[model samples]
Target: MVQPFSQSRVKPEQNLKSLSSFNEAVRLLRESNSIVITTHINPDGDGIGSELALSRALRYADRMEDSKAGLHKPKTISIINVNPTPRNYQFLDVDNEIRTFDETRDAPTILQADLVVVLDTNHPMRLRTMEPYVLRSNAQKLCIDHHLDTSNFADVYLIDEEASSTGEIVMKVVEELTSHQIDAQMATCLYAAIMTDTGSFRYPRTDAELHRTIADLLELGADPTYIYDQIYDQWSPNRLRLLGNALSNIRVLYDGKLAIMTVTQEMLSATATTDAETDNFSTYPMSIAGVLLGVLLVELPDGVKMSFRSKGD
Candidate 1:
């Protein structure tokens, strides 16, 4: 039987006002065993990248020769998510460690976890179908996210909304956990996280420190060109055709202040493309000369899905 979250044995650290929150988070993670890592549903690069990076870092504990170094490694460190990794991001799963959650298959793992680290999201509902199990689990919960919403569900919150990405927050935690010597695998994941979230380092969050971090990642064996190619250059003919069809339907609204495009089931079928092929398709509308806001309306079987992006503010 899983324990209730409120009864967690770990006491909150004294200094909630300072970096002690981070220190305490690190302490809880270091002391925990049977750890399970997860992120939000339909995860983007930041969520997936952060999950993989932290998973790799935690796995390092098992390799440590010194058992007395206070590396209280869990017997199992599982990376599970509500949805499958996007086709393009599959390259980062070098270890093939990410598993999709199934109620029958993964509920036991969730229930048995001594610590559940939720990355890139703070709300349990963001966990989708896995929310109930995560909420009921007696394990200590830790949230490492950059989203503005800091709704207090997790026992430990390592949130920095000002940070470029959740990957940035995870980088700091990983460094603190590993004594600042991150492995190449960690670097690749973090690089992907920051890269996608910052729109290839052009977003407002891309500061000097972020550039330095990217430089360090490059020095530590992250192949930026290869990563970019894998994510952007590998589109199939069907996907391109689908994009062409969607773009043809672009509609200017609010006197060019908004650009709207729709990808319907008929268009997808005509183009021989799956819905997954439309991932990040909203960027196309935003690229218009005078568009300030871009919207992509995807026609799902049950409903219409919408995504919005803005030029500024």
Candidate 2:
């Protein structure tokens, strides 16, 4: 669905022929006065975590390395989110550093950037209300994502579809940005990103490379059990009730090849459950042998949010 070019798209790997562009990107960041970084709308953990880690790396290098004969701290790097994240990601504490801004109120701050880095989004429309500022910013733009389906709207776009998660891309960029080892906080951020995107190491995307990276993260202080507990263990009693209702009301479609569940506004009100609690409500159907796809139809105040997940053949 990307435009501005045709079937002859220049892949990131293909574009890596010149070290000049790569050096230009790093230099641009190194010279930027004020940076405003953001991710696609509905930022998942991978996007959020990458923005934080990247900013951290840039700042770390600035703090330790002097730009002109070791005399400057670089500029400020601001991380913004198009919208709030799912509750499970709250544990990341990205709110403390990156700061989330409402586009309605903070238009000026968004437009006045020397550099804009958009993460995780493939389609340009996915940038949401912040899209205008991204376009208007005379500042350079960079795209760091893991989706092959991307629009080269930025100057430096490093995308890798083979990556298990955007966090992996972030890891590579972090190493390039700074040689410093991953700290506990960095490991925690990365672990959250990789774990969620790869379905806790259960997704088919999880390969040896992913495992090796995760092992390195573990040595750097990634604790799977604790992070899993924080991400998945916390549940409200009403959420349990909602889960039960969802499982009971689910239907097998496509002659038991697909499973479907619907969460009406009434169901939400009845169980005192918010939208976040229904994260895995469709998984019950996915566990069934014949079901290859599980779809959840959630009715919101205005419209509906549809979630689709594929399992087996």
Candidate 3:
């Protein structure tokens, strides 16, 4: 969810007021007890982090209020994502709480939820496995995202495309809604979203505010060394082989303007690359200086899945 005036040169504070509905959405989300948090299908770090971080912030704020008011309004937090996230985020807080859609699981009913915080995704229908439950949920919906195209389905939308990732947007949103200062764990979670989405700060989307946000994250205890060591530096040999096979098929097209790489089913079997291992393989071609766009075609059982990336704006 992005604010309409997000791309303007106006200060974030001024732009923040541009979306007057943001606070309203936050308020509505805060008042609810039974909550469901979700994101788009084929979840990314930004999506997963924003959904989880927002959930934790809201739950903490409500519990704190209960403690102060002497009314134990402990809320039930159930996070249901369309699909599981990559192995990289397995260590983040509340990762275990993230449930895939299952009618049989005694998971809290979506329709019964007092609120649903949809993060990092504009379109709810893209939620795939969680669509049935989401449609069934009577919960008031709020959206927080930075994507360009968004569904206005949420009762309230707080979208800002200027922000590098939903994690960055959620950071500001959390700051506004809670008294808790950003901690090491929270910084790590938010940093993961920003780091991955911004191409480790090399994307054209990176801005002064993004750098400032990261500086604060580091001050709050984000360790780039550790993050890099795990995310990229520690790639397994099989993962290397998987990329090798895919790169072997890369083809230059449109007079070398497009670098296309196709991953067939046979390639997956040959490298023993699990679905998780193939994550982020599409980014490899961006490292090539002459390529303007990188295209990855992954052969699924039913059809081919494509991931497109471009260096040009």
CA error at residue 223 for candidate 3, angstroms = 1.8
Badly placed stretches (over 4 Å) of model 2 are 1-24, 66-70
**If scored against the real structure, what TM-score would every candidate get?**
0.91, 0.88, 0.89
Local accuracy of candidate 2 as per-residue lDDT tens digits, 1-313: 1121112334655544323444555677777878887888778878877777778777777766665356565677788777876677777774476566677665676688888888777666787777887888787887767777677578777665667787876776676667645677788888888888888888766777788889898998878898888788888889988888887888887889988899888889999988767777766767888888988999989999988888655
lDDT of 3 by residue, 1-313 (tens): 4443444544867666746766677678777878888888888778877777777677668767887888677888888876776667766654477887776672347878888888888887887766666766788888888889876687888777677788988887776656646667677778888897887998777988789889998998989887766566767898799889888778888877888888888888888876556678888766677899998888887788888888766
Clashing pairs in 3: 1-145, 1-159, 1-160, 2-159, 2-160, 3-159, 3-160, 111-137, 111-138
Give the backbone clash total of model 1: 1
In terms of TM-score, the best-performing candidate is 1
- Give the better candidate number (2 or 3) by TM-score: 3
lDDT of 1 by residue, 141-216 (tens): 9998888868878898877766789998888778777766788888999999999999999988788878988998
- Candidate with top lDDT is 1
In angstroms, the error of model 1 at 187 is: 0.7
Ranking by TM-score: 1, 3, 2
TM-score of 3: 0.89
